[model samples]
Target: MNSHLLNGHYQILKLLNDREDGKTYLVEDVNFPDSQFIVKQLRPPSSNPQTLTILRRLFASKAATLEKLGQKNDKIQKLIAYFEENEEFYIVQEFISGNPLTDEIIQGQPLSEDQVITLLLEILEILVIVHSYGVIHRDIKPANIIRRESDKKLALVNVGTFNEAITNTVDNLEYMPIEQVNGNLKYNSDIYALGMVAIAALKGLPAKEISNLRSQKNQLTGEIVWDNKNLKVNRKLAKIINRMVRFDYRKRYQYATEVLNDLKKLINVEDDQQKQHHKKLLLVLTGVVGCIILGVGAWQLRSPKPGSDAELKLYQEGVNKYDAGNYEGAVEDFNQAIKLDPQNALAYNKRGDAYYRLGDYEQAQADSSQALLLNPQDANAYFDRGFAFSQLGKYKEAIADYNQAIKLNSKNGYAYYGRGLALAQLKDNKGAIRDFSKAIALKPRYTEAYLQRGIVRRRLKLRQAAIQDFDTVIKIDPSDAKAYYQRGLTQSINKQKYVALKDYTEAININPKYIEAYLNRGDLYSDLGDNVEATENYNTILKIDPKFIPAYIHRAIHRFSFGNYQGAIEDYTTALKLDPNNITAYNNRGNAYLELGNKKAANQDYSQAIAINPNNALAYYNRGVIRSKQKNKQGAIADFQKAAKLFQQQGEQDSYQDAQKEIAILQHNLAPAPTTRPKSNNY
Candidate 1:
């Protein structure tokens, strides 16, 4: 126990901290210099060897879970290694270099409302992932949140469910909701703690002080007294925070995503600027600004807010269905709403959003365009159309529409977000980053903007910077499987194959239908010569989606590499069936048949490929070899000559030379070969 080295590997450098659950140390791997890792000594409650052994195994399993969660996200601390030594469990994890958020929060310097929103969004995003794993972080406080120095983003440390102490009384009672103290903890308990954190930061007071201040007021009242504290928060955000910390658990946000969505809405241009920024200006310059405001309202009134009661009910139902993730039901309800209220431009815009979610970009574009025609000043409609155009790969058109949306409502962060996506598609990475940064500045919790910016940064070869952006995205929405998959790709590029594999596996676990993750993992396995695993992944893709052409082609290539000629031929044939004019499929299938010594079949496939694209030099070369093997000397000579010419024209010098050699052999075989040999020896 007194040895500096643990298990003959980790050399203790310094003690980080100690708690009731475990003692943490910053350690260095004796095997890996210039590497730092966190080591925790987990002490079992019982001193019995058997109990300790059982706990070690359980701890190992938990380590795997922690590793998976960490790989799928950047905000979570990554478990690197774990082992049992001296009847005590030792867990190693990656060290994050950052200061605690508590340290960043000064007593007299409360964070701005925007900063509060950003902080809550970041924490809620991580909580969503944590809760999905059925793990409750009973300790939600500023100290647990680290302002990571690498990216200046928030990273949640020491996810609590890994330790039994989390279920006990929380170390910081000030952050604990009343229900949790009563031993009735739920997901909303975390929400309550986050709300308290927000209030504490805004009030520039300790959580205990704020709670004590609130406890003196009427507990039965539904109104939050903090709202009356004259804290600098918008009404909408205040309403959300109030609901989050409500005395009644049922009144709090039921889920982290619910809180996140409301926080995003609070920063929306329509909600923030229209209501908060211009309120006093509109009152003071009522005559001038009122007309502009009236025009905006009139555009909205094209749908008539007081329309047929039944129609309005249907529209509200559609909105509710959309919010509940029932896109198909929402579409039906929206259709009914449109039928009942034909002049509803808002209905058209909402329906367009529904279509966009369903991946029907054409229909979405049409609906959004119709809405714009009905109300030319509708920024939401323009934004919707821009999103549709971006999805359709018409980046320039999308950029134009986004420009119009931004012109109409300059404060629209989402329009900036849409424009950034289009600019990214247009190959303007710098422009895309600018717009994305702007969007993030205006809407601090804009997860998609962070994601797209990460992609652009990765494309620009800013690996660490890109990773930081992806980390922010994960911190904003942990359930985003795409973010994990993308981070896996970046890790793979960085030569962290093992870490990348864990990331891809986590992504697949989160979304079993994620074909791209499977395909990428299969490709990585194939590159590493783990053909069995690669084939299994490809098989899984086929099972999930038999019509997926890439799976068939990739599987065929894998089979061909392993000398499974017939299997490769069958897979390539399936690919050809899915895409009749697939040139690569025909050529590859022909090569597979040639490998199996089927000259006739191989010749037919080569001929089909050449017919599809006459300039295919490989097809010509392949057909020439088949003819030469068939003993058809005249046909072989003719085909070889044609192949040699085509290969030369295609700048394939080696292929051309090989074809020329075949032609000379065919000609000599057709003529009298013995006579030519004798003449060459004499010369």
Candidate 2:
């Protein structure tokens, strides 16, 4: 193509790529020489008149929708102008300049998991806008994503037009089944392609190669497996992708809006893990690497070349011993190496690694610090130091070392993952997720990443998405009892009691000694009104761990429900013994005493509970009842009024109303004495 003007204003510059529907070209505007654009020349499909018209209508409808949607999100490339020239339709859009995610992966210099997640979130936000306008991108792959050179953020391009144009041909349509061949035409199809892109980024493989791994008969299963293994980024992310790419359209996400919501949740989870991992990596890099560098420098400056070589040799031997799990031998060899070559960084690093294995974090940190001083650029030294720092709970220093390690080697997924763990310890969820995502991008089969990300997601209140992540964990490691337990907890919170029970049972079956599972299952049983089952579960937990206070409390509540006041009191007392500040136990015990007609005991218990937690309106009401029974009408009225005020403050109208009723009764009984009382006093 010539560099001359085309369509009056667009001057052809260079061809970018050719697609089934059109040729994409980089062009400059004749009127504005500095402006650049991507001009797509659409070739109308040669088909019957009826089919051609339908395709044209679809294209026009999609184009119009895109124009409306483009105004909402800045992440999408905007279409500028469209016109018909020589019977061929052409559309001009903003030209985005940057490398594709595919290119980055192929160059073996892919972005961190955090970066990938950030980009995906940006795209997802754009999808939300596009889908809201009843338009699907229909194709979303790495090639369609561009990283802006100026901001380093991602943008979506080459969307909404080409798929319809290419698939509109009558002859091609007759041979290709819409459901089988045109599966990529729907919104979820785009999501499927995006998942493939994510998998490719994680595994450093092409998307088509992963697709080929799926058996024709069990395509969805293969996708799930590959996505789970490669993106071990998080369980929640994998599940979201799995849902989006479901073979059954009905089972897939019905709208891009749903996918967007899921993407936000996944982003949050991954971000938290990323931050924690970054911190741990920092600590290791600084402490371990610093020590190794210092030790190495000291060894190199030692007198006698022979002695230095011998020391180096001894250090290497020590490292080998450490690698072989002979920690004692390794320590002996490292000491000899240090004696001969006092500044051997490698020797220090090896010794530190050994100490770490031996659960001597302090010694490990000391050795790692010496190593880092000897070789500032040593990534391994930094990593070891950070690990020691994290083990010692020196999280801030650990994070700093991880940052240095990442600066030296961006592909260090372990460092990022470690940092995420550290950040999580500090309750920096957002930062942790970011580091976790980076780790996932670097090493997709990182099962720990998924587990951590799922936990963070749950913390962020993304319950449904968190459940999806737990499901991924289960798929990756079927024997993961913790995953099952966590998923059960989330399901229970979401009110899926049956599903929660099943997950809890699975967890208990896998690890029969899981006390938490038994306790949670007991709570679930109680929620379902299965008192017998609930009591049995509580008893089971008590058998395993008798000191479990929550179990005692639950059992007490169950006893009280069954009118076993004495048993309830006994259980409540035991619970209080286990945990002295158990206000619930005090309150429940007071109820039991009241039922037993021990007004004084009931009053004392209620007063104690109220003293412990002044905001306990129920305790006040109960105490008021006791006072009324004891004929302290004024005291009872005061307590009832306070209870009503407290209930009203808590937004409990029903409880407030009940308190008011009691207050009214007390007021009627304490009504002013008639004037005859004065006459009696005078007499």
Candidate 3:
């Protein structure tokens, strides 16, 4: 099937392997050659249509299992698609291009102690998820573990599903646990294999030879001794490995995380010991105070301490670079500062802030964590880490850090503001308002806090209070386009259309590139029945930034309201091209297709939207309407029930009630329900 296109997209480039079961091909997208995939084809015993149908069902069932596993772990190769074509089944998955561990672990040429530790840790990380899923990778050997070429991350491939069981273990005797050979595979079975791999590396031999070495076996138990006196390995690591490869499966680590924790502890202990040794040596060598009193002019240098002069110089340079927006340069200077004085908490805190600016939240979190370790009471370090956590979507952790910062310094307006943001994400609007109000009390002219509080009030239906917050912000800084735009939103909600139009106009005039202001102005004009002006506003936003998605969505919504269904479809289509997973565009376009009576396309769009965001109540409700039209009563009721449940969970009481009404109608009256237009493009 070379060069044959499958799924209307993937074209087979080259056959990777041909086995008794099927053939595996390296395929690339017809439109994008660089987007590569591996397609596995399953061949039946004969071309009987019934047998082929059964084979197709089996392929799809197993594919679903692999797909679910793919979503829960980043270290596992992803299952992209599974389909049937020309009476053959195809399973497409992400192609991980890398050599196996066998290439790196040459027999008789052992890896360094650190190298082996790193490999064990990386593989164990992947196994942690695999084991958590209650699945055992019966085959855990060097050849099966791929070290990714791009990032050097170990990605586990060829996972055996329940349908495609891996029963063969004759050649992998060295890596297979004894219990696994007897069909009793525990989670720690993989741990035994990994430990054997480590032992093989330490002994400078292949795992097969190490497993069968009679000389290394215990005198009575027949268990192979793992560590050797000649092997250069840490005592702690050796002990951990011994427990991992215990002859009794029950004696080994019961979980991968247990082993991971122990390995991390060993690393931490080694680091602390090295640091202590260096500190003691420095103290002995830098005792120059007595020499200076004895008139020994040769003793000119002294021991470095926290915030030493050299470190301070580098720290100041880092601060200047950070202020100038040279985050990478600031990080370099801070690295030097920390190297010169390892205990410089100020340097670490500043570096964390710089990393935050550079959009490296993980590094920012790490540096801030180190700063907190050195100076536990540092409020700024807590705030910095909290800010990083907020960006990383760890809202609860961010709130805890912000709470600590506020406890250390109650006057810190930034802490209150950050805590408010985290609370808002967690849907605690009242708590967010309280924090925002506290922030405003601490800094009366804080525009961001006022703006956020105004938005929250608007969401809570306190339009007048929200308007007042916007007014205060505008009064403080008249040139603030965002404040004027927010005020316009409140005014629009309060039915002051003309006043809202003027506010949007002022916002646009102040910031000529304000896309949201343009969209809102367009919406206001549309509400006023000024079609030409509304279209012009949306067109202006598109002209400013052709790739801006909101402009297309707003224009589509405007066209739909004016009964221009085809124009709306065109705009939604363009928006989807810019962002394939734009749930708003997909759902709205589905509505347009439904209006045009293209039920198939509409169903497809709704299904795609639901696939992208499973909690999409609107998509489910709309699909229910279609199913009702098609006289699928049971399917319609099921969809309506699911939609109602999701709507209730999402706090859309009106939509939830509508969905319940649909289900009742479908169940009793058998009448088709009206379609809903959800606030898909809320902005």
Candidate 4:
């Protein structure tokens, strides 16, 4: 069909989309040439008069609601008019000069956590007003949300309530909550739709695809496996979004206002955290000082005081400097305080902390030991000493000191956290997890503990639990790029390729200098058979970190797979330059050389590999083949014998047999060939 005028006033400029239910078009108003608008033509299910009457009533009601809604909110698209043309309904809405949310979304890729939050906040702000008017945006998907180019603000378009009158309206099924299908549409149903939209945009996948990615299914809990796809979402924001999209509408936010209120709280919390960071540091110093005083023994009141006024003043200054991140200055102040009052344990402990911050584990340990000597039961000194030991790679000593600290103060979260790190270093994952759990119980917002525990969980192959842990870290600190990157690793291992890719992308988006994220993303792209995209990612990695050996090796492998022998050789050579002792690199480079018919070069690489690892049967076999081709029968036989012995020792029976056959062929060739040629001529 051709583009035509709608209602003899709006001329269809082009068809925007053609769906089962209707056709959406960009149009110009003939009455006002400067005005551009969207015209949607919908056909009722049937030509029956009764159906037409019901459709007309529903359309008229929705149009009127839109016009009023648009009048109240600039973010909502304005309804200009609606009319019946022939037997179809034509609705005109103000055109928005922007791209749909889906336009920037690449399937299996994700937007940054902050970007997604910003999008949700803008959409929810508008939804709060729409829901207050008892309107449910029956359709909430990426395509329905326009991100305006002018102000970069998101606009909610195509507002229509799908109640009993339009219950059968075809819509994006992926975004539809269960309640909508059950005809139990509530205001929260819109919240569910919005949550799905966020998920779709974050995963760079459509709602339908996201819906299928759900691995957790229960009456009260419906969570997609891709929910933690490496986006460092704030914990509160993640929880809020999860609740918003609950399968049971009753579990979701009952009103858009409810979600808006929570988002407002998140915004305020984030703003306060950003704006009052210095204030928080001062508060921390004050709190730590108060704790130290309260925890001191009655010996402090004895004559010839443990600390003089001058010492106390210097100690306080040291603490202030420490809080301000001036570790060297803090250390100097602590030294002066200690000189003035040798018995001041707090001064020694604070100095130890400054030393630790400066990466001087030796001085930190000495200061902490002196603090412990002055105050035998000081938990802070034990904890500080434990931290120093842990940093020095003395896991056993760290564990011992952490135990002492915990014994002195059972509620010390840092002690437990420190013990957990020590245990992790010792490969005691269970012990580490217990300590981490204790730390988390004492401090609910312990991001480091959560991150470490997540890493341990991943190591233990408790992948789902690991994901939950990373999710918590993200919630506590949305800007934790490492959390997102780690979560992506788990997702990749879980075989969620696209979801893993999205997570890696989110990590890179948060931290542009994240080389590992780029490498993982490139690998995922290669596995997905998009070599071009994969090469681009590898190129990006090289651009960011040219000295990265793995990038060169991986790109070389990629080049080799596609018959690019020269490129593969170049990459392999670069990788070898970065890591000269890499056995795999030498072997791979040899193979690439062999492919290019550089037998002498191939022989040198194979010899180098064998020299590095004499048990490398494959390398010996390769060298034997090259020697045989060069007519060096004796050298070929020696190499084959070595290859056979090594392969047999390594339990590679087939390889061992191949090497034996090659040896036998060489031996046969070395024996009475003249007699065999005479017998063949006689025959």
Candidate 5:
């Protein structure tokens, strides 16, 4: 507690922090006045006996490894000296002058994407060296990463050691075999700890609770919860982190070198993007120079240059109109430009964009192809051609052209976003997400990228994240009916019926012709038992799209709830007529027929429903009821027994009990009648 020497040499200056494992103190070396150091006490007597022994052994081994590691990398903090006093061991190590990464993240100043990638790659390199020496950093987390203030160089601290605060605690201890525990103190455990550290850094939260993270029901994979808003991570980097932090160890990168390789690839990608941007700028500058030369040549050759100048003016006007979203007017001006200057590649590209906007794929493709023929290096022409291909559902060709456009101009966010959409159509979710993220990196306000990324996230079952993306989309474009509709669907999946209904209603308000919204809203109403509103919405959908199967299904349910058995049967029958494999319709129709005393028709419908879906337990129950009513007591009992078994298999205890009751009733009814008729006949 004083500014005095401890254990013969370390001059204790001030206490930094203390944990269950040991205490950290700012200290100075007695041998060198200018030398500063940190003294860490390992396995203080206050720790548990078992943990003390483990730490004593671990530290003795780590000290030897650290001595060797220090010689390999100057950044590796040197263990200067060590000694023991009063049953507590202290280690003197080089004092790092910097703040912990933990403080930065906790203070709401997370590292940028570039900084994160660099830090991770450096740590991975250090880890590869440590592992090669048969040492592992069993506890890897933000607190162990130190950023030097003067050089801005990040160094991994406290390597080849466990954070006794985590592993030395006896409470809630998970016992492992001695061999496994020892193995866990080696490289495999180091990999696990590194993954946890990566996740914590990217998500700005502790990764120890990753097992409890929500996933789709029955899914073995855990969802990655990267706080991109907080960390400012690009999509590509987030993906790399996700793969690293996989809950299943087998799915994660087996070695630190593999993770480092991925980081190197990302670095290369960033470099390539920069080079492409430079090339595009050079090309644009060349185009400007060419235009100036052409202007000079025309000025020298023409006696009257009015007509040529007018053509150039009209072409510029057409480009402006196209940029302003006036596709029809842009097309008109483009025609005039072509009449004045038929060989203008810029005019052709602008006209192609206009045609693409008008949904004229053939004309768009022709004009874009012409533009490309005239100027093969034109990025805009490639983009236009890609758009046309995407419109025609030729995703492969669209992707190829988009690749070409990106090669010519990597800063073209539009091309990246378009390629993302095409990839999504092809069901390449990871690729699509990467492209969308790149688009977002280039254009922060890109609503379409957010919307498309949200859809892909939902497909990946990252529901909460998908909701956030949709929220961003709605914030950007308030009248986006599809955004509202998709958000409502996500809410419904999350089982928030009222919230889903509100979203669906908003969608309908934005675009009344959104038939899916009407149907979905009706379904939500039906789920909430608002049959009247459900029926009204269903009716609206049917009026809009007469062949809508869901509307018929909902109307049938509404009728069934209101005791309109015949009407319910008619509606269900109509739904099934439109779609023969509509199992729900068949089941509902069977129930309606059973209520209306049509036993034969009810049985047939139930059989068809069962044929469509072998797991339709309700159909079995309905058939059992029909058999009971027909006085075939033995057959009734058999059917009820089967129904009860099926219900039990499905974990429907109440339905199983109902079937059991029917079985009991049928068995009782099948008992022999009393024999008392002989006396009356004799009289």
Candidate 6:
């Protein structure tokens, strides 16, 4: 083949380089004689038509993507054309008249930290656009980067990955990451090569010599150890470089933006902070100055460190804010205090209290536990932890912590109140009432204690006494939304529907965004068969918070009740995807599936509910019915027995009897029992 005018309208000026994948050449477009272009020849090993066909398609697609990128980014080389000549694919690219970066990155001459940082910023600017398009530039070496002659701005060349050529002595392989070399190119692979280039420049090592200069290498983990201490680079910059070139791609910066952000932080923020500013005084001084120095020396020996005053001030400010009921502001002050002095137990405890007030129970528990770690005997911290546990439904743990708090400080009325709430959740109604009474006795105006005792009273079916307790709480704080909500629940249970509706409305008026109030009001409307009102309430919940899964579930139940099985199935499926372990979603979705005559899908859902929670007796019973219908007699009997045992253990007398009846039917090998109805985790 002639090197001149190899294609109909192109001429090869000179061969630029050779590699395993293909050859790149300096070429000129014969039609546009005033301009020159770079042409890349794709050399596939196999001459088979099928192999070449796939390669040609991939080549054209990559060329199109590069053209798109070049249109948006001036730094990237523009795609001129791509064509097939003699069964070989060639990509023509716009030529940049410039000096290669290899000229600046000379061996035996290390670039300074500032210079390397600047270089990184320039390269990363191009990469941000490249990576955003989900395209990985497999080749990012010094020779591939060009400092344009007209302007000093660097221009990127060879943007496609098809130029991958991994050979023992190949210069490209020096900068190519292990993942890229193995043909699994990640977005970070380009970052890794760019990092390697920076490392080589900073170490005064050539591409070939850089590989040999590894002081330590973990072959298993693929950690590359370059000398940061011996070089003049900033330690922060060095760490960034190391992270970019980690052996495992997972450990590397997953995005160009991430690496760029870290580099920017290191350059912009840490650079100025690297120096310490202080005043130096002369030793030559008068008697007064000497006395002052001696006094300061003694104070330094006895007083807290320089930053202790600031920490104490912040803690005091946090306490003041907490007293003012500004929980958010208190949290901000406590955060600063903690940052100033992490070992301050008081600050952590105060922050925990603020978090508790904000209803962040998990964070409250964490901070209170940290406070306890610093000072285990602190009764307030113990009470805080107990309160968080109670809110999170860890009733036993809450009780245990409350026990500790009471032991440490017998006058801790809040501890007793917290323990009462936990005992109420555990269904120990009498114990909860007793604890609440003790709390009220300790603090005569303990309104929360009265409120919680009311709840326990209602659980025990002491309706009049529960109402009296709620009346007392209202007397103490007439504006309490929770007190009204609890009363509404009690009235609803007593069949006072209109009264319950009024109480729910009052709660909502006091706290317009009260989710429980909205839920209960909607439920009452649903019970009354007022479809329009119920729908409005549900829609309001969704509009307020689309991620409120419980509202979707309620709407699904309403749909199922009205015979819209398909709509119910879709809603339940969405809920299940968001909360896979939700027993209500599984059981109800199974119900919807069953009504749709999809017994197979129903059986799968019931099985899943059982898998998530083995003690779910309803799920076991439902699955038993499906198995019996499918004629798996022994399997049905086994499931029924399990359901009966669990139902009996849980004190569900009616359900247990039903399960036992099913077990008898299955054991006798007679006709299957009636299908078990779905259970709900109700409002």
State which candidate has the highest lDDT: 3
Candidate 2 segments whose C-alpha is farther than 4 A from its true place: 1-398, 422-428, 581-584, 603-683
lDDT of 6 by residue, 1-683 (tens): 24667578888888887777678888877788868899888776667989777777777677778888788677888998888878777888899999988898888888888888888888886887676555777779888899999988898988764553211223377787777777677888898899998988887777778667543686676588785466666666788898988878888887666776677656544432231010011111222354586674321111114668888788768766765558999999999988877776667877998899899999999999997775565677788899899889888999999999999889878888888888888888899899999999998878789988988889889988998888787665444668888999999999999999988876665455778888888888988888888777877888888788898799888777778899888878988888888888898888889888899999999999999998888888888888888899888889889988998999999989998888787778778745555455553
Best by TM-score: 1
Give the per-residue lDDT digits (tens) of candidate 1, residues 205-316.
7655765756654556844577664565777678888889888898778877778777766566345335423532432344345457676443333433464888888877
After superposition, the stretches of candidate 5 with alpha carbons farther than 4 Å from their true spots are 1-306, 309-342, 477-481, 509-513, 542-550, 557-565, 568-683
Better of 4 and 6 by TM-score: 4
Q: How well is each residue in 357-383 modelled by candidate 2, as lDDT tens digits?
A: 899999999998887776566676788
Q: Which parts of model 4 are misplaced by more than 4 Å?
A: 1-314, 475-477, 609-683
Q: lDDT for model 4, on a 0 to 1 scale?
A: 0.78
lDDT of candidate 5 at residue 328, scale 0 to 100: 94
lDDT of 4 at 209: 76
Cα lDDT of model 4 by residue, 456-550, tens digit: 99999999999999998866555567888999999999999999997887677556678999888988888788899999989998998899988
Q: What is the TM-score of each candidate against the true structure?
A: 0.58, 0.44, 0.51, 0.52, 0.42, 0.47
lDDT of 5 by residue, 540-572 (tens): 988899898877877777777778889888888
List where candidate 3 sits over 4 angstroms from the true fold: 1-312, 613-615, 630-683
Residue 611 of model 1: what lDDT?
Answer: 98
Ten contiguous residues with the weakest lDDT in model 2: 674-683
Cα lDDT of candidate 1 equals 0.78
Task: List the candidate numbers ranked by TM-score, top first.
Answer: 1, 4, 3, 6, 2, 5
Clashes of each: 0, 81, 0, 2, 0, 0
